[model samples]
Target: MKFTKILAAIVTTAALFSTSVASHADALTDRAKSGKPIRIGFAHEIPWAYPGDKNEPLGFANAIAVGVLKSMGYTNIEPVVTDWGGLIPGLQADRFDIITGGMYITGKRCKNVAFAEPMGKFGNAFIVKKGNPLGIHTYKDIKDKDATMVTVAGYVNVDEALKEGVPENKIMQVPSNTEMLAAVRAGRADAGAGTYFDARNLSESAPNEIEPTDPASLPEWTNNWVAIAFKKEDQDFLKAYNAAQAKYLGTPEMLEAVGKFQYTKAQLPGDAKADWICANR
Candidate 1:
């Protein structure tokens, strides 16, 4: 009868484990459907997620997230602003449920967090003096002229530059686009690097101060799409978030919402799977 009791205990334990797993899954779904606000991390990139005049979050990512979540029965969404470099860490630390910055879904980043889906795909553009004094249009151009290329810290452009043979000394990593532009404007760096959309916005915002050159096609870089990042373990949350994203991303409403940002159809990502991007890389 001792053996019989031990077998019964094992069965009971297995049943309890199964119930616990289901409870956690139900909790995640219920918590999301609850009216409680979900926090999303944002950085100060224009047209992505940046603080407005009243320090309120406003940008493409923020708007998209707010719209989708509200329709998903969520009434509140909070934007947790942080530096670009801090986005992933903040999410991992539970400072936010997800990061809504236009962070690219590179293979390197996939190891750290689970990505929902592609939000937008874009190429890189360079910011230079109004008249293109140094003719710095590409990483190769910067390398050829031995000019300094300023990029935001944690941006992929730095890797592209280094791979293109831009010397370490010729690259300055700043904390934000503001600092990169400042370095270029003050003649501290020969040029600034960022996404094409960012370059266009910067040029329009400061017309006389800088001009955005046509995007330079870096051989080592492919067109990368950005996605919302969540902790790797948040499978239930990630799945729900992707469902919400599917309802809005690449839709006509999506275009209208982000139109003011000047993104083009060519820059929009097709329904390509993120897993493919991660695996091929």
Candidate 2:
């Protein structure tokens, strides 16, 4: 428990430290005119951002990032593989012009950096074992039935479960998504909560031992709008990205090329978790 608190504290401190750095008031325009290749930092989220063999980054977001930038006339875009926690800070430090991960457009996040129009939306939900030992059907099922939930450490999923009345102590926040899935399969946890697409991939990875629960039964007000993160003041990059995104939205050819890289269960639009990311969220 102490370790958990310490890790959370470190994350908070990292966020604060980054905020302090931005307070120096560096003009976002000084380096806005780089004619050089846009160096994009991307954290690998398999199936979403494919971490291919040798951990080469790939996937919808990776493809979209490269595709969008290339379409916007940047031919020398580079990919920087980073852990989930480090992706944002590296961007803040100017290590990359953009971190091509699927970032949600949330009010809290917008304060740090600008997010382009959502690249895609995702619904948040939990996955339970077949038969659902605790009959875990809803957020309330977790609360009233004394079920323990699993989540990636420091990820928003843990706090979302807490808001549903599941105690913080009842939630397990491991360091990575794989560990969270293992906990559920090994019976160390009753359920694992995450993005619906990711849950689908986990289930397909081990069909007999795991199964996804109905999203409708989970908390109602949850959605994730993934966008690329940029330096808060990088209005130029934001404009460039938005222009490219606008050009591709609703186009058949763009979607076809990008869809080829997604996981098997995620090939269809709004698969499994319907409505994708709720427009209202």
Q: Best lDDT goes to which candidate?
A: 1
How much is the lDDT of residue 259 in candidate 2? Answer: 73
Cα RMSD for candidate 2?
Answer: 14.5
TM-score of 1: 0.87
User: Distance (Å) between predicted and true CA of 81, model 1?
Assistant: 0.7
Candidate 1 weakest lDDT stretch, 10 residues = 26-35
In model 1, what is the error at residue 271, expressed in angstroms?
A: 3.4
C-alpha RMSD for every candidate: 3.7, 14.5
Model 1: residues with Cα > 4 Å off, grouped in runs? 1-18, 26-30, 33-35
The digit string of per-residue lDDT tens for model 1 on 93-152 reads 888887888888878888998987887777888899899999987888999998989999
Q: What's the C-alpha lDDT at position 160 in model 2?
A: 73
Error of 2 at 17 (Å): 35
Q: Give the TM-score of candidate 2.
A: 0.78
What lDDT score is found at residue 194 in candidate 2?
A: 80
